[model samples]
Target: MKTYHIRFYENRWIYYCISLAVVLVGLICNVIFGTRLDIQFTGGAVLSYSYSGEIETQKVERAVESSLGRDASVSVNKNVRSAESGQVSNNVTISLAGTNSITPADQTAVLKALNKAYPNEKFESLKMDSVNPSMGQSFFLKCIVAVLIAFLLLNLYIAARFRKIGGMAAGFFAIFALLHDVAMVYFTFIIFRMPLDDNFIAVVLTILGYSLNDTIVIYDRIRENRRLMGPKTPYRVLVNTSINQTFTRSINTAICTFLAIATVFVVGSVYQLNSVV
Candidate 1:
């Protein structure tokens, strides 16, 4: 067997520069486009209706805006059950901002407009929900607090566990990496116009946990290698060797996890499952 040595830490500055560039770009994009917060976070009313005919999303949006005297976001999804069964349904969801509670009159007005536009098609209201602005604000605060607590506990754990091998520095570096990942996610959301909602929070938390676990595994390998190589081993060699040893395992794990998630995302999208997608 032939062994090849890779100098990862030797060019560490390149990686740092690349990460910095990505983060800076993301920051600039967020500043220019602003964040897109969903009804769950921004406090708004969502009205969902199921119809059996083809409906233009623009027409529905225009109808809603004309009725409410304000612009609203509208989305339409088509679901086909089976070709043989010939079962098809279109779901229309309209999101309106600025009000916590939706009044019956508002709902009636929207329905009237929709009927006027699509006289032949029957629209059945599936659900109408609203969130108070104050309640949404409270939820946002709670999510922030939870994330902070998790980070603090993770730092403490890493510092305590790797104390013999510069655990505090390792912990701080891990946190920095996690933050970078979070920033990237935020940037992606802004770039793609994804809603900042409960799903966004879930994704951030999941990434933090996943990245921390990977870091801990690498850190454990480094500690073990240091013990084997003795204190005379150079820090760079020790770190690089540890990473090289675990690189294959890490790649395989990531690929498998990503494939699993991708499968779910694809299936959800195909089925028009908004919550899953």
Candidate 2:
């Protein structure tokens, strides 16, 4: 295998500049396009309607907006359920995520608009759900607390495991790496206009574990190298050598994870599972 030596420490400032650029761009995009919180985080109304025939999603969106005078999302799932009598049906979920509940009059008007738009679709209202904004805010706070607690627990564990050579410092850096990973994910949702939902939480938790594992592996290698290289070794040399030794493993791990996530995303797209995508 061909190996190329790279001086990461010497170019650390470049990496910092790149990270700062990304953060600034993300913040710019966030300001241009505000954060979209899902019903779980923002109080909203969800109206699910079963349709007998083909209904274009764009038409549904237009109908809702025209009737309600507000923005809404329309997700259409195909062949979602099958009746025992061999009739197949599709579902259209209309979501109005805002601070207030959708009024009955507004819902009726929305239904009328939908019916007027697609008279042959036979849209039947399945269910209407309203989420309380205060409750959603509370739930969102709880999720944040849960993530923070997880980070704290993981830091404690790392500190305990690596107590011999400045365990707290190691743990702090590991948490810093985790924070970077999380910030990327957060900025991605903002940039792409994806709603912060359960999927966001799931992705964050998954990333925490994934990143922590990689951090631990590198830290373990560093610990081993420290013992092998003697106490008199320069700190820069120790860190550089340890990182170089584990670079291949880190690359392979990242590639494998990317491929796995790509596969799942493709599958979700095929199934029209927008949330999963």
Candidate 3:
């Protein structure tokens, strides 16, 4: 195997510049678009309707908007079932979001609009549900508390495990990197207007866990190299060497993860699975 030396410390400024640029762009996007909270976070209503025929998502969106006199987030799902006679039937479900409880009158108005749009298709109201804002607020607070506790525990674990080689600094930097990742995810949500729901919490937690694992591996290597190289070894040399030794492992891991995610994304797109995509 061919071995090549990499001077990460010498080129640290370049990495810093790239990271800073990305963070700045994300912040700008957040400022421009603002945060979008979903019904799960801000308390709202979800109206689900099932239809027996093909329906254009755009038309359904228009119908809901006209009836409610406001724009809403809309999603459609299709299900296929076979009867005992071997005949196949398609069921389309349309979900609409609202900021308040959907009253009987409101449901009637929406149904009237949908009926007008699709006179031949039979529409059945599957369910209409509303979430209280207070409950959403409580859930949001619990999520925040959970994340904070996780971070604290991770920092303490890292500090105790790697105390020989600037453990405090290592833990702080690892936490900082995780926070940056979380901020980037939040920025993406703002830019895309993705609802801040339980899914958002899951994504943040997953990213934090993945990043912390990688950071701990690198820190472990640095601590081991420091012990082998003795106190005479320069800090810069130790860090760069440790990073270079693990660089291949990190790259391979990232590539494999990317491929897995890409496959799922492609399948979701092909099948028109909005939630998966």
Please give, for residues 23-58, the per-residue lDDT of candidate 3 as tens digits.
787677778876677766666677777677788878
lDDT of each: 0.83, 0.83, 0.77
- Top-scoring candidate (TM-score): 2
Tens-digit lDDT track of model 2 for 63-141:
9999988888888888775565566688899989887667789878988998999999888887899877787678668
Candidate 3: segments with Cα more than 4 A from true spot: 1-7, 80-99, 116-122, 133-136, 262-277
Question: Candidate 2: deviation at residue 198, Å?
Answer: 0.7
Query: Which pairs, if any, clash in model 2?
Result: none
Q: Estimate, for each residue in 75-96, the C-alpha lDDT of model 1 and write its tens digit.
A: 8877835356567777788999
Q: Model 2 misses residue 97 by how many Å?
A: 1.4
List where candidate 1 sits over 4 angstroms from the true fold.
1-6, 56-71, 77-89, 100-127
TM-score of 1: 0.81
Count clashes in each candidate, considering only residues at least 3 apart in sequence or on different chains.
0, 0, 0
How far is 182's C-alpha from truth in model 1 (Å)? 1.4
